[model samples]
Target chain A: MKKNEVPQDKSNLESVNFKELCYAVDENGEYTTAHSTGWDPKTIALNKAIEEIHERTENAKQRVLNNTTSPIEYYMELHKMDLPILSSYVGFWKWRVKRHFKPKVFNKLPQKTLQKYADVFDISIDKLKNIADGN
Target chain B: MEIKFTHHQSAHCENGVVSNLMKHNGFNISEPMVFGIGSGLLFCYIPFLKVNHAPAITYRSMPGSIFKRFAKRVGIKIKHEKFSNPKDAKVRLDQNLANNNPVGLQVGVYNLEYFPDEYRFHFNAHNLIVYGKENNTYLISDPVMESVTSLSEKQLEKVRFAKGAFAPKGHIYYPTNFPKELNIESAIIKGIKQTCRDMLAPVPIVGVKGIRMVAKLIRKWPKKKGTKVANHYLGQIVRMQEEIGTGGGGFRYIFAAFLQESSKILKNPKLAELSTEMTQIGDLWRDFALDLSRIYKNRSAKEDAYNNVAIQLETIADKEEVFFKALKKAI
Candidate 1:
């Protein structure tokens, strides 16, 4: 032990109550070095944390990578997954447009165009709307 | 729809239990969370599909469930290894020994394929029991189960199974406790504690900024609820003191820690500057611990706080007991 390193007694070690320590964090990161036990909880906690980090770094690499996903990463991963999007005339129209394909001027005259598209896929109007407008 | 960050709040239900948390979420948690040791569920190894958070709700188990699940554990692919690793090896060995000896369930299931007439398996689940082609032959049958003496198919048939056998063949039956589902409800409870604590854990510098957050909570809290709410909120705050294990042992811990640290500060003339902030923080926590202790003392008076807790715990324990008893009797 260093000259400045005060040897820990039972009181100092006991004072660092786990409940208060937990609450000190809960009630706004309020903490004190002293507890009944005279143990430095922050140091103890920090050391424990560092130990756990090292343990995880050594032991659970795959799990860490899997759990390390952020919201953006989650979205990106979801996008990468082969999401099934129904394809049809109207769907084709939207997909084509969304893909930056120029909409043909005479894409389809009104009459049975929408109905014909729905007929081809055997879907309802709502599903067609969902497919077409990205609902 | 995108699972927004806000929805995370709703993800846990009114009671704070989660019916199901994307399975991945389930994997993130350990079993200690839903552990109602006495009366929660019969089979410990029966993989929970919908761990309900509510105390009222029980495992959707009917009769005969224990036999099926226990049998699965007793089946095949049972591998035994001598204890070697330092971490979980002792615990595993102890559990195994207890299970193999008696009173502990250590078997697992293996290749339980469904056929028209008979089920096929490659190995016995329990190595403790020998499979000599007769009743005693229980060495191994399935990959999931291991370490067993007696507690066989014959025993299972004799034991009491739940009347509800509409469940899958692999479904566990229990005569004792119906499990409380630990889904959104538990997540909410845990989240409330963890998130609330996490929010509280920013260095609350004793001056203006620290005061501001407390004031903000006061104002925002009022806007959300009236005096009743305030009282309840205060009660919650008080409850948290206990939840975080504050009043019981926290004060002693803090005092001792501070005493040690403070002594070092006194001794270290050179590093004396380093002790100032640490000392201040330590002092505040000491004070807080005292305040929380006072609250706990008061709260206990209002009701038989521990009695209530014990009562609540008993219900859970009873179910577990019944389930295990029924399971033992059945197997």
Candidate 2:
């Protein structure tokens, strides 16, 4: 790729940070180098990913407040996991997981089950339970 | 203790680490050269595996394979270890630094505090070099960064022991020996042949054919799944292409640069011509990404947008099939 060759009509160099070295080619057809003017298109794409994850987290938080789902759902979404993954991690069947998505079912879950989930998420059981309260 | 090491950032981490390691041993090699010599280019779309709830779509080989294969081809002996205890790992790392050896560390990106908040993710295969340690901080030379940085000992411990898919498990690697001379000709030829074999592998969800498989799956997505799911899938593909490194062309541009350098090293004009073709193909990928982005940003996008993307992907697969076939014989 032509280093520092910004694609047209995509971005401006206004906020660009030209500190990172990027690989370019010299007139000799050999590998040369140039600093990145950080407004590269890849930065835009990365920002989009961050936005998507943020939105998912926010939506999960809203779901917990409405009591439509339990804190387990919120934690799973925060950890970027689906029901299947969470089920396998906790060694519970998918149906058990679906049941656990309810506030009542989750509140009554065994300490062992909560500990398994907390371990998988690398968080304490208290933090896992109080996730909806922004703990 | 600190080792005298120079850092140069690159588009991808593995190739950059390998290139720096080569330079540390007094062999000046570009990241693209290391990438090509390792036969790093690949495509895979495994629906059974999910990354962030979308099917896993990888642009290159498994993590660390590129460096492993490159080191083997260059006849370099490298010491790699994984520790059960972080304390022991820290001791070993400090010992290596005291011996004037820089260590490559595999750590998760999620907990690397130096990274911009927007750029940090749960990726576990991120590679960085630790060259020195102060009272509480360790000097880090992450390939994707603008310059060298530092991390606290506590912060380093968290990332090193990060738990997730492809956990690092306190893994560290450093070169122990280097060949006196390299047979560039044989290495280039072997690299090219291996890349060709990998691209043409018979697996339905791997290699160039894998691109086609994803295209087919995408075409059916809007109908088989709902528009919301299909659009999310489109966003995921673009994410794999542009966000997770190799700069915006899904590694096609980097590989094209590699082919260009290889042509000069091997004195083959055909390879140079093929390198130009590869650049055009890379541009095609960029165009497809641009189109996909429009679909992702527009929730009310027409139903045909998914089909349009599928068509673009199949065209890419067709071009790549011919490109690799020619590459197989170009050597």
Instruction: Identify the CAPRI category of the predicted complex in candidate 1.
Output: incorrect
lDDT of 2 at B22: 82
Instruction: For residues B1-331, write the lDDT of model 2, one tens digit per residue.
Output: 6678898888788888888878888998888888888888999887777776578898888999888888888788888999989999889988998888888999988779877555556778999989888776899998877688999988898889776578798999988988898666687788788988988899999888899999898888878887767777777787787553565478777787888888988899999889878877877887898888787676787878878988999999999999999999999
Q: Under the 3 Å rule for N, CA and C atoms, how many clashes does model 1 have?
A: 132
Residue B157 shift from truth in candidate 2, angstroms = 1.5
Candidate 2: docking tier: acceptable
Lowest summed lDDT across 10 adjacent residues in model 1 chain B is found at B10-19
Per-residue CA lDDT of model 1 for B1-331, tens digit only, reads: 1111111111001101111121212222211121111111211112121111101111212222222322222221113232223234334423433433211122211222111111111111211111222233222221112121233343332111111112111221111222234243323233223212322334442212232333344344344654333323333332222222121121222222222332342353322232232233334433433342332333233323323333433343343233223322321
CA displacement after TM-score superposition, residue B278 of candidate 1 (Å): 5.2
